[model samples]
Target: MEVFEKINYLISEKNLSKKEFADKFLSLNPRLRTTGEAPSYSSIYGYLSGRREIKIELIPYIAEALNVKEQELFNFDLEYSTEFNIRYSKDAREIIELLQYAPKNMIEHIKATLQKFKKSYEDGVKEPTSS
Candidate 1:
């Protein structure tokens, strides 16, 4: 989904009107443009209506007003796919979401840690239990 679509989806999910979002967005007091002024309500409304492109600089404030991480603005998968019929705990889900925005180096470290856990599990499985 495009950024605007994602924003609209989030707005609906949050049960907020476009006007309410615009007001909350301004309440955050984000300064942009050469004039160092916050965008006007009409400008924000234009962005929501897809009449104006959202500025890249406004993403942080927008995300904050939407009560989501900045990366969430670009994430199309608002709901997890049920194709696998797999379910995880809320904490696990949170970890997965956080991993989406984690730095590459951190991901590499996590991969190494997971490999170690996998190896340990495999080794334990290979060992016969004593009666």
Candidate 2:
């Protein structure tokens, strides 16, 4: 996906309006907040509206502000076409990588555990309060 498209996706996923996203992005980043080149009101509008190119250097700041990886803004496909996209958090990505090397039996065990967790959450099973 294009940079703007990814930005839009994040904006929607995080339940933030365009202006709010821009405000938060500007406020959270100290370096960019002070610099004139920061993604200010006008610049953010330009980026989202496809009137300006979001500079490559700004990708990291954008990702950090949104709590995502910088690669998500780029159009590169990490794996082949048949694979699921790696759009997960850093911890999830690490788990995915670790699972790739896990034994088949261990993978099955993990899957079963995950399924149980999913079912539990889906069924509204709350955790016990800690003593």
Candidate 3:
């Protein structure tokens, strides 16, 4: 899968229309475009339709705007492909290293905690509990 395919998959998985996704992205990163706001519809359409490629320098901002890790922007296969030579940031690299050492049970526990935390936070609760 290429970057465009991955992005399309993510967009569909999230059940977001292009305009809604763009709006949410802008909400996350108000400084994404030179206008200090989200990209216009045409810009998004151009990128998604392959008329314009997503620039390397804008990858971080796009990932942040989408509330995803920068590495997630690339297709998983691309990450393993010899042709793809992107470098991870120090923090992201450390996280990848840590994941290698993490136990399955630990990863599951963290996932559960994160789910609970997200729910609680969205509900404006104080904290999440195991139960």
Candidate 4:
């Protein structure tokens, strides 16, 4: 049977055994396998085994149920640029949420730190101009 190693990785990272995860979903939504509104036990097993492709509709729901960002489900390559972008997206979201209630002093510190980091990055990439 085919298997996407990435799926297994994500499952493990979410601290869920395959059975536990599937059971949780089925438990949360009883109409799943019984009513054909969702995948059956075999189908979820197929996804875990890589014998089936995970449908796009389930991505967000699975991520939410698993308590992680959707990016965690599909991104297996840590070295890929997409990985960096996804992480940045998650981090930015978290920062924005936290900033909503941040004290003035903390907000100022964060802003100053970000500005310094941005300036340093720019300086590092600048080329010398000829007179």
Local accuracy by lDDT, each model: 0.79, 0.69, 0.65, 0.65
- Position 10, candidate 2: lDDT: 70
Candidate that beats the other on TM-score, 1 or 4, i.e. the better one: 1
Question: Mind giving the per-residue lDDT tens digits that candidate 4 earns over 12-123?
Answer: 7557899987887565563343355878889888877877887666666667667767776665445234525443544564677689899999999888877776676578
Q: Encode model 2's per-residue lDDT on 1-131: one tens digit a residue.
A: 56787687677767789888787778766344346455668888898877898776667777877777776666334421234334543345469768878999999988888777667767886542222
Q: Give the Å shift of residue 27 in candidate 2.
A: 1.0
TM-score for each of the candidates: 0.59, 0.55, 0.49, 0.49
Q: Candidate 4 — which residues are off by over 4 angstroms?
A: 1-4, 30-36, 79-131
How high a TM-score does candidate 2 get?
0.55
Q: What tens digits encode model 1's per-residue C-alpha lDDT throughout 1-131?
A: 57887788778877899989988999999888766999998889888878899999999999999999899888655244442222332345479869989999999998887777667667875433432
lDDT of 3 by residue, 1-131 (tens): 66766666566655778777666655655344445555666877777676777656567766765667888877465344454343433344457669878999998987887798789978987566766
Candidate whose lDDT is highest: 1
Residue 66 local lDDT, model 2 = 79
